[model samples]
Target chain A: MSWNVGVWIASLLTLAIYSFLYKDNPFYKVAENIFVGVSAGYWAVVLWFDFTWPNLFEPLINRGNVISLIPIIVGLMMFAPLIPKISWLVRIPLTFTMGVAMALVVTQRIQGEIFPQLQATFLPLAGVSPGVLISNLLIIIGVIATLIYFYFSKEHKGVLGFGAKLGIWFMMIAFGASFGYTVMARISLLIGRVYFLLHNWLGII
Target chain B: MKQTLPLFIVFGCGFFMIIAFFIPLGGFQDVSQTFENWYTGVIAFFVFVGILNLVRVNTERIQKRTRDWQYSIILLIFLGIMMVAGFFIGGREGRLFLYLFDNFYIPLGATMFSLLAFFVASAAFRAFRARTPEATLLLIAAVIVMIGRVPVGYWIWHGFPSLVEWVMNVPNTAAKRGILFGADLGLISMALRVLLGIERSYMGGGKE
Candidate 1:
């Protein structure tokens, strides 16, 4: 029902991808390859215009920031792998990036996740309602039990074994909940696509 | 020089960042910010590297007349069209670019993810069996969560939603917190190892 070429293209592409549900065919392959190509091109344009151009090139060219050249030169060094003779030059940039990334991870993990989680886990047991008290106790025990389960260094025996077993039960429940949420999210996406097909393309809704 | 130099760079950069976290004075923060920007700029070029590699591989396939090489041509054409529309035209704000992105890219991407729903459901049928006590518990939890998440559960029982909330907030949080603690500890140690040059795996296999 829609006369828009864009909508038609979208509808066709969606159907082409969904065709894979039946079996692998030329339509699916074409769609799949187009996805890959377009995704790569999209990222290329984004990184160039949004990131490298503005952050790296603009500063150096317009603002006359000589320091920006450091990253630009290092970035150009990333292409060293394409030339076999000086391929070892690639490690410099790789190591530089890895160092910064790993450092950020360490600092952020401690400051963000570890401290807050540990603080939350150490809840006051006294002066709470019956339901809240039970919930808090369960949370504390469950956390300890789950941690014990992941303690591969210790041999599972006696109390440790019991704690580990309890941990598995808690983890199993958590994983199941996570899986359910994931499936529901995917189903929601499916519903959206179906709505688009019926309402936008076919005008049957 | 290659091996030692990289190790030194890692130590230098990593330690600087860590130190900068503590010492926010005397331009340490500024230097750290610059390093962060440098990392972003360097990493941005990797996208082009990826695209170049993709082009190389597809061109090689076309040259060799490999199976399904015809699809490669279509892929290249689309890639070129998008790049031209994005770069040579009016940029990302260009009409053709936005049209392709809104219609072609978004629909295809959404459909691809949505297709996983069917496969996941099919897999769940085979895998969600209650063979053991643990499996039984998992199945029960999953069913409860799935039901309570939707509107139909409210029609069945008013209490289902509150029950689901309690399960998520308490037990789920407990398990997730435990996992997070363990993982973050491991990550910190691994990061330290890399900084100290004890983890050489990332550098790949080669002679010093």
Candidate 2:
């Protein structure tokens, strides 16, 4: 009974939200705001549980690990914004964060993405089937053509332009394929949720 | 603090992270663990900012009595009611918050995603004309991908199944990664600038 009641409530709210397809109505906006507020509050608690409380307070109280505090101080620097008097202290943390994030983002791109993609260009076709060989060759050609399309230092008149054009088509196809796959994945999840609510939640099954 | 302060913070954090990568500094783990913690705090901070922005926009609309002012009213009301429910009645025991999150927010976000579907379909249908080689290829590739993705492609041709796989795994991955890699490089540069106080644009660039 408890489960059924919960599922019924959930299903009703789900229907209220799905009604948004027609237009942006009060029901959707109310739901949207509630979501925003609740998410914020939940996140605040989680942040404390995950990071601030765990590293800062937990150590100070339980472990008495005072030496492990310089970084915590650095982090508390973020709260400097609240102290209108010494808000400049915030710069210490903000600057460090952005810089580190940027560095990580960039270096990871090179070491992880660039090297692997470069490796993908070299295809071993000796023992491969005819179909696989053709596919690999087409991929190589597509990459070259796509690169040519972007070369605008000179006019894309004859061969280069044609190749670039082919590249564009290839890119489009790739995007469409990814989009489809993503939609399928999301829809599958949604279907699972519905199935749970109908059968497990309400025992309709 | 002014935006330049953020720059210094960025620089300091970046320098420390780099050092950590090469040499396991005396308290490197402590420093790095702090970095991990930053994610939740940062996300929480952004969530606050988002709510603030939402309230600010809707409040102004209400004050001005705009065309959709009524909708804004409903928004604020819903936001208010949800907080009350979660805080007073539900607490952590109930799924009042989670219910709203998954049922409402998720669907709404998904619809926003699906909205792109109509836009893409319309754009392809109208914009994709066989005027040039590139355009023609795009049309052909779009068709192939469309076919390759669905069960129809397998029925029509045997090669398409593998063709789709190759397109996604190879050329597609390369091009996308190239763009992403460039973006990462740009972010690193910006982060460095902020750390060094060289880039003051984020702060709205005051006297500092």
Candidate 3:
């Protein structure tokens, strides 16, 4: 078995968190609070070392990039909310961030998601094996039917209703598959923790 | 003056990015790259804001002697320890910081997420009823997927894996693509509204 202090501490903490399965108690709360605190501190260190030091401070101080000061000053403006008199100054940084973020989303969605998906959906159905042809036809039909289901402008009646019904079936199947995969992922994580308990901490395995 | 200045900044930055996307010529790309870096820098400072807010809230709770105020003390203590280890000892390369992350953080994080497996399974048991044809299809799909993904599934039937693959590739892709198209169209329009200053909700409420 491992005699390492770190491993011991980790094992205790893991058990502390898992004790919540029995009931909510002080140990679980302590573990939860520690998790929150450590996570916040970790992010702070990462932001300072990985982001601010390298991107903002290094460029402004060492490389003498005057333009870097623009963001630094704006970033500092985020602290304006601490002061009642000039709290509105925070809006500047907020708007700047929002503008850039929104613009990127618009362009990226068009180029990355919308176009590629449409291209993939519009496959040629000319020459192929019977199985390949059936699969391709299903894909094309499924996409159109699903789109038609989401089309709320026209009421679902007659052929539109049939298409919408087909769409619901397709979506239900997809959602079921997604849920199954997610469950497996979580179970795998549980298995990993169990393995750590048995093999690493106790040496049973 | 406050509101107008911010709105103007939004318009300027938003239009510049959209234009730069189309052009990408001369110094446009370089300036755009700089702006991207600046965005990252600005966003980084929010982490400090968040940590400070967390500290302030916990400190208040301790002072008020709220329910389980003792936990706040532990939280602040660990937060301080992590920050000290990170800054003084060294950032990522520091022995103490890395030890805390590898032992404390990883185990806690993984265990927390893994606990969801029990809840998900319980929920599935209750909710996976086949009252309708659609529900039956969903149940069938889920069972096939779960069984086919594991080694025991192949022992039961050779074709289980391929059927699962077909369900994923065809129906899953189609459903996801349809949703994505609808969602992206809405997002693009909303983004345009923000750019044009029609959506002023982000600026918060006040006079002008």
Candidate 4:
């Protein structure tokens, strides 16, 4: 088995973080803090090299793109909070950012998620096999009932209430499936650690 | 100066971008794309701001000698080391940077998330109690899905995997799609409220 100092360091840090399962301790805290600091620093460097330099600075300097200055100035306005006298200036950029995101997402989400999902639910009911027919029927009932559950304009009574009740069952099952899937994911991660320790570190596997 | 200006800025940029999406004109699309690049740069600035804030907070903690302030020193050291490695030595492609990332960062992140397995087990133990009819339904479904997902269940019964697949594809998809539709509709309405300046909370507080 091949062994190295980097692998040793990784194994120890992995163990240190896992030590948190027993209780909170210095090893865990140190590992946690280092993780945060390193991640932030890494991302900061990435943003500068990947985004700011190529997209913002290069254009402004090489091409004399004066328009790039507008965002640079607005971005600097975000730091107005550091100066008590000009704190309110931060609001301008914040509003612009929020508004732009809102506008873009409003249209994009409809086009991407809402429209496609609705179209997908248009399963052909006629001229299909028994299994396909049953599945399609379940999907239709499930969608309509779930939508009814969320409808707040009118009080749920009789048929509407029954549909809502059915909706709740479907929702509960979905949530349960999600929970199970998450548990499986977590267990898979744990298995990875175990495999690393056994195969890489101990050479036992 | 405080309120009205920001609202107007939001209105102008928000409406302009939305209108640009519809218009096939060159100037509109160019303006929209340029503003998008600007937004991207502005977002990059916020990352710097975030790092600065973290440094400031940690520095203050170390200076004041707060609880476990020594850890803060370690954090700053690693942060500085990482930045120097990335910026001066080379970007992430550098040997030292990749060494630190592959060994230190990857292990820490993986172990951190792996720790959740233990907690999730304990949490599931508590959650699986069938106190009500709905709770019972949830518990039963969860148990079935969990069992069906693992190989041991298939060992006990060969049909477990297919049963799990059916549950996931049919009921789960239907339920999730329904929830997504409702949620997206609400999201659009909220976005509209923000664009219209009815929701000024993004400026720090209630509508102004």
Pick the lDDT winner. 1
> Where is model 3 chain A poorest over a 10-residue stretch in terms of lDDT?
A123-132
iRMS of candidate 2, one decimal?
4.2
Given candidate 2, what's the lDDT at residue B62? 97
Worst 10 residues of 2 chain B by lDDT: B39-48
TM of each candidate vs. truth: 0.97, 0.73, 0.97, 0.95
- At residue A5, give the lDDT of candidate 3: 90
What tens digits encode model 1's per-residue C-alpha lDDT throughout A1-205? Answer: 8898888988999999999999999999999999988888888888888888887899999999998998898889889888877788888888999999999999999999999999999997999999999999999999999999999998988999999999999999998888888898999999999999999999999
**B1-208, model 2: which lDDT tens digit per residue?**
4654465466667677766766666688666656655533443444444566677898999999988677677667666655555556565345765665555555545544544454566666888798876566556655666677667789999898787777677656645544454455566677666556677654442244
* Backbone clash numbers for all candidates listed: 0, 12, 0, 0
User: What's the lDDT for residue B10 in model 4?
Assistant: 85
Give the residue spans of candidate 2 off by over 4 A: A1-9, A38-42, A55-57, A64-90, A125-127, A144-166, A182-205, B1-7, B24-30, B33-43, B52-124, B128-131, B147-163, B177-197
Q: Which tens-of-lDDT digit does each residue in B81-186 have in candidate 4?
A: 9999998897868888888888888878888888888898899897788898778877877877889988898999999888788778877888888999999999
- Give Cα-based local distance difference scores for all models: 0.91, 0.61, 0.90, 0.86
Off by over 4 Å in 4: B205-208
What is candidate 3's lDDT per residue for A49-122, written digit by digit as tens?
A: 88888878899899999988899999999898899789899898899988898889888999999999999998
Q: Which should have the higher TM-score, number 1 or number 2?
A: 1
Q: Tell me how each candidate scores on DockQ against the true complex.
A: 0.81, 0.29, 0.79, 0.72
* Candidate 3 residue lDDT tens string, B1-208: 9878998988899889989999969799888877888888898887888899999999999999999899999999999999999999876789999999999889999999999998899999999999999999889888988898888898899998998899889888888888788899999999999999899998887656
Model 1 residue runs over 4 Å out of place are none
By summed lDDT, the worst window of 10 consecutive residues in model 3 chain B runs over B199-208
Residue pairs in collision within model 3? none
User: What is model 4's DockQ versus the real complex?
Assistant: 0.72
Error of 3 at B119 (Å): 0.5
